[model samples]
Target: MSDGERVEATPIDPPQPLGATGEWLASCREEVARVAAGFQAFEISDEAGYRDAKRQRAALRAEVASIEERRKSMTRAIELAVREFKDGAAEAVAPLSGLDAEYKERIDEWDEACRARRRDELEAAYAEMAPQLVTLVPFERLAGRYADAGKWFLRSTTGPKAMASLEEAVSDVARNERQIGMYGLAPEEAEAMRAEYFSTLDLQAAARHAMELREQRERVRALDAERAEAAGAPPAEESRAVASARRAAEAFIERDAQAPALEERQRYVFEFELSADELMSLMRFVRANGIHGRRRRAA
Candidate 1:
C-alpha cells in the first residue's frame, strides 16, 4: 500500500453472552463487532499512518471500557440490597457486643485470681529457700533480680516445676556471692568483682579477670625492682636524687681544691634544710663515696 492508503482489518467475533445483563451485553457486543468490522489496518509507511492506527485502537478500547462500566452499573441495585441486609444484621447484633465483653471480663477475672493464688504459693516456697541465702544478699533484692526471668505464676506451669526453677536461680546467685566474698579481696577489689558479677552474671570469669589484673601489677613491680638492683641503686626517682647530690658534692670538693692552698685547710661550714628524700639521697652518696661527715640532731 502507498503511504496515504489504508488496509482493511479482518474482523474479530464478539465474546459469548453471560450474566443477568445478557441482552444489554449482546447489544454492546454488536456495537463492538460493527466497529471491529470497519477498522482499517494501517501499514507504517510514515508517521501519519502510525498515529491514525494508535488513535483508532485507543477508541476501540474506550468503547469496550464503557460497556464494562454499564454492566457494573446494572449490578449496583443488587449490591445496595446486599449492603442494606448486612447493615440490618449488624444492627440486630450490636447490643450483644457489651455482653460478649462482660463474659470475657468475667473469665479473665477468674484467671487472674488463679494466677494470684499460684504467685502466693511460689512466694511461700521461695521464702523457705531464702533463709540460707539471706546472710549474703537480701531476699527481696535477689527476688527483684530474677523477677522477669520466667512466667512461673501462669496456670500452664505446674507448682513444682516453677519452684524448682526459682530455687536454682536463687541458689546459683547465693553461691556466687559467697565465693566472691571468700576470695578475701580488698574492699575496692571486692566492689569491682561485685559490679562485674552484676553486669555479666558470670562469677568465674570475673574472678579470673581480677586475678589477671593482680598478676600484671605484680609483674610490673618485680621488673622495676630487678632493674633497680642491677643498677646498684634505689628506685628510678630516688636514684636521680642520689646522682644529683653526688654531683653537687664533687663540684664543691673540686672548687675547694683549687682555692689557692686555703690557709692550711681551714674549716668551712654549710647549713641548709633538706626534704626526707633529699636527705636520704645525700646520706647514701656520702656513704658510697666514703666522705667523712659528722651527724648531729637539732635540739
Candidate 2:
C-alpha cells in the first residue's frame, strides 16, 4: 500500500577535516578529553581498590601520552605548510632595538645588590662567632708574651718548656682548621665545636655561608682570568665539556632548520629530515657519545 510506513534513522556526521592551524584541533581535543575523563576511576578508599586504580590510571596516562604525540605529529604538517608572516613586524622591532643590553645591565646591578646583602648577613654571623672561637691559649694570644718565650728559651730550663708550648700551639691551630672544615658536616662534636667561638651560629647558617663564599669565589674567577691576561700568562686550556655544550646547541639549531615547528619536548619525530629509524640511530649515538653540549655522567 502507498500508506506511509514508520521509519526511523539516526544521522551520521560526515568525516571532518582538520584546519591548517593547530589551534582549533587543540580545542576539539580538549572537548573529547573532557568527555573521556567523566568515566575515570580516580578515587579509591581501600588498598585493593587503590592498587587497581593506580594501574588503570597508569594505562590511561600512557594512552594520553600516545595521543599527545600523534596529535603533535598530525598538526606538524600544517605548521610546516604555513609561511611566515610579518604583520606589524617593523613596529615591534623599532621599539626593542636597545632593550636587550639595557636589561642585561639592570640584571647585573640587581644581582650585585643581592650579593652585597648576603655578604653583610654572613659577616654579622661571623662577628658573633669570633668571640667564642676555639683555640689554644697561645693561638688566641694578642700579647707579645708568646713571641718573647722563644727568645727566653736559651736563658734557663724554660727553653724546653717554651719549645713545648710552641709545639702545642701548632697542634691546636691544625685541629681548629680541621674542625672548621667539618662545621656543616654534622659531626658528633659539631655543636661542641661551635661552642668554641669560631663557627657560624648553626649548621644551616654554616651551609648558607659556605654557598655564598663559593659564589663570591666564582665572581673573583672572572677577575682572575682578566688579571692573567694582563700579566701575559697563557690562557687556561679549553675543556672538552665547553666544546661539547657548543656542539649540542649547534645540533639543535641545525635540527630546527629542518623542523622549525618541532617542540622542545618532542625531539624524536618522523617529520624531521631523517626517517624514524635514522633518527633513532642518531639518538642512540647521542646517548652513548654524548650530544654537542650535554653529557651523562659515567655510572
Candidate 3:
C-alpha cells in the first residue's frame, strides 16, 4: 500500500481527554499484540511457512515507519504552535521591559556622577587640611600616607574626625618644617631632613639625623683643613703646640669614626661675648667653614 493510505488507515488524531487518545493507543497496542502472537504460534517448518513469515515481517516494518512519520508531523506542529505563543507573549511585554532598562541606565549614570563628585570633594578637603608652610607635600602624598587607614576616603570618613586626623598630620609637617629651618642646615642636610620627615613622619628623628650628617661632614672638612694647613703652611706661621693640638684633634675624629653611630660624642660648649662686628665675623666664619654650632641662652 502507498504511504498516504497506510497513514490514513491508522489515523492518530490530536490528544484530547484520556478517553479518545488512550483508546486509540490501546487499539494500536492490541494490533501489535495480535501480530506478535501470530508470529510466535506459526512455526516455520516448511519453506512455504518461512516465506509467509518473511512477508509478514516486511508489513510490520512498514507499519512502524508509518507511525514514526505521523509522530514527526505531530511534533513539528506542536513546536510551531509553541514558538508562535512565545512570540506573542514577548510582543505584549516589549514596551514595559524597554522602559525598565532605560530607567536603570539613568539611575546608574546618576550614581556614578555622585561618586565622582564625592571623590573631588575628598581631594579638596585633604588639600585644605595641609599646613600652608607644607609647600613640598602635595595632596596625593598626604592621601597615600593615610590611605591604608581607610577613614581618609569618601564613604567612611566624617567631617570632624577627618579634620582631627588631618590636623595631626598638618601639625607634624609644620613642626618638621620649622625644625628644618631652625637648624640652619646646609642645602644637602635640609633635603635629607625633608626625606626623613616624609618617610618616618618623625620631627625629632629627622632633626637628629640631619645633625649627625652635619657633624660627619664638618669632621671631614675639619680634617681636610688640618691637612691643607700642615702641607701649605709657611715656615713659623703657627706655634708648635697649636700644630700638635690640630693633629691630635684630627686623629681623635678619625679614631672615633669607626665607633658605633649611636655612640655619644664628646661635646664642648663655649660661651662667647662679642661686639656686633665680632659676632658678625664669627657667624660668617662658622657658616663659610661648615662648622656645627648651636646658640645657648645664658642663665
lDDT of 3 at 12: 45
lDDT score at residue 211, model 2, on the 0-100 scale: 57
Instruction: Using TM-score, give the best candidate's number.
Output: 1
- Model 2 C-alpha lDDT per residue in residues 92-195, reported as the tens digit of each score: 56656568778889998886776455434433433344433323222224113233544322334353454455554444544655656665634534444444
| Residue 85's lDDT in candidate 1 | 66
Q: Model 1, 1-299: lDDT tens per residue?
A: 48899878677433222234567767888987887887767678888888888999898789778877877876775576567766876887787877898989999999999878866776667677776545455544555666456567567777777777788878788688778998978787888887777666678899998888766765666565445555667723555555665677789878977878755655545454544445555666666666675755344
Q: Can you tell me which runs of candidate 2 are displaced by over 4 Å? A: 1-179, 182-213, 223-236, 260-299
Q: How close is candidate 3 to the true structure, as a TM-score?
A: 0.35
Q: How do these models rank on lDDT, best leading?
A: 1, 3, 2
Q: What is the TM-score of each candidate against the true structure?
A: 0.46, 0.20, 0.35
TM-score of the candidate numbered 2?
A: 0.20
Looking at model 3, which ten-residue stretch has the lowest summed lDDT?
Answer: 274-283
Best by lDDT: 1
